[model samples]
Target: MKFRSSLCLRRTAAALAALSIAGSAFAFADDDARRAILDLRETVKAIQADLSVSKNAQMQLMTEINRLKEQNRHLTGQVEELYNALEMEKRSTRDLFGSLDSRVEAFEPQTVVINGESVTVDPKEKQAFDEAVLHLQDRQYKQAENGFKRFAAEWPKSPYRPDALFWWGTAAFALEHYKTVISTQNQLLREYPKNPRAADAMLLVGSAQAASGNLKAARATFQKVQKTYPDSEAAVTAKARLASLGK
Candidate 1:
């Protein structure tokens, strides 16, 4: 009975020791689990910060790309306008004379009418004017404008003055310089009322005004054409334009 009791006490003590060891292990495991949870939370916060930064950068890059594309589109429009002006100038040169205009000074300013009597032109003025027409043909619009301006200044009272004004306005129109066209065409109407090309100039002036988004002014110019040159081609085109406005 004494031996059995001692053996029983030993087993009870072993069991208590095992329970204490298990309790300590459980405490350590809880501490480690809490630390792991804190680490994961910190890692999650860092990832969110990085994501915000990446999204902001992507939006900014997209905005820059859009801005660049708009600028590129604007530049392309300018290039196309220039090319069209050049082609129009070539057409003008071809239509004016089969031979190209010369650039020599002292060009005589005169009219070469298909139906009207020819006048004696200053050789220098004629050459300069011809050269200006050649520039129009080449699509050198600015140069053509300058050349025509020079011709107007040289022969302000010449019979061909109306014709020069017409060409000047035409060149400006080809360049999308509509305001200048209106000014030049008005000068043609007021200064050379009896000019053969006056009716045509008025029509073109109205067309320019229309193209520039001045609907009221264009209508006014067209009205003038209808009143003054009812039988002219310009009047016919003006009537067509007026009829199409409501559509």
Candidate 2:
């Protein structure tokens, strides 16, 4: 009975030691779980911080992009404005040059055909010559005579001289300026014998002499016209005048 009591006490002491070891192990496991939880919480906090920094950077980048887009739009508008201004300047320059060229042309010489020949004449000179011819066409006899006289005096070497002289003689004849007609027509015949108006001029001189009662001189003049221009209209008129003088 004493051995049985001793064995039972020994088993009770061993059970107490095992229970103490199990308590110590459980305490160590709880400390490990707490450390693991703290590490996981720190990792999550670090990840959140990184995400915040990234979001801020992304927002700043978007702001910068928007600013750059606005700047580009402003630059584009300025470029378009410059292009339009350049185009307007070009057109203005072109128009100015066009007007200047036209003004310059007004003072420049122009080429014209006169009496089957090309001649270069000043604009002012052409205007004067045209005005004189217009006076003749209007049958303003005194004005025509004065205009032709001025044209002959001002442009003596002009190709239109022969026509001007002949018209002067015609105007003088219409005014019954017999001496003027005789002198003018004679001058034309002497200076431009081969002129297109030569036959007509000689016919006019012959008629003037007849009107002045110089039949002998008139007859000789008409005969000369018929001989000088046999196939001309002046020659036909001269023949009729000669027949009338003979009667």
Candidate 3:
């Protein structure tokens, strides 16, 4: 009986050792699983960090691109404004040059048709004559007289001389200066006898004489105009004057 009891105690001890070994192996397996899970979590965290950095970099790149685009747009606007300003300046310069050229051209002599004759006249002479005629047309008789007098004095050899003298007498007659009309018309008839204005000047002389109360001298002058230029318009005026005198 003692031997059997000892053997049973030995078998119980062996069973207890086998159970402890199994428990230790299960504990080791649990520890290994936990370590593997921790490693996987670390890897996932690293990947997340890298992805965040890439996203931030992409956002910064996009912002820089947008800024550059805005800067380019602003620069383009400025360039367009400058181009428009430059074009306007160029046009203004061309206009100024054209104006200056026209002004210079006005001072040069030009061909003009006067009294059915084409003549080249000095700019100053033309300007003076035109201004005198303008005064006459405007009925500024006193100004007309002075301007014609100046023209006669300045351009003594001009083709406009005979006409100027005739108009001077007419201007004097309009002002009721009878003696001045007589003298100017007589001078025109004496100096330019062959001119087309001579008969007109003689008729004006006769009228001025009639206005000055020299009826006998006016009649004689009218008869002379009719006898000298019978085919002229002045002769017709003289005939009317003589008939009126006879009445």
Best candidate per TM-score, number?
Answer: 3
Pairs of residues clashing in candidate 3:
none
Q: After superposition, how far is residue 189 of candidate 1 from its true place, in Å?
A: 1.0
Candidate 1's displacement at residue 53, Å, is: 99
Compute each candidate's TM-score over C-alphas.
0.53, 0.58, 0.62
Q: Local error of candidate 2 at 108, Å? A: 2.3
Model 3: per-residue Cα lDDT over 96-126, one tens digit each: 9999987886888778876677888778888
In order of TM-score, best first, we have 3, 2, 1
Off by over 4 Å in 1: 1-115
- TM-score of candidate 3 to 2 decimals: 0.62
126-154 per-residue lDDT for model 1 (tens digits): 67778989999999999998889889999
Say what the RMSD of model 3 is. Answer: 7.9
lDDT of 2 by residue, 1-247 (tens): 9999999999999999999999999999999999999999999999999999999999999999999999999999999999999999999999999999988978998899977889898777777778878887898889888988898899887777888889898988988887788888898999999988999999999999998899999999999999999989999999999999999
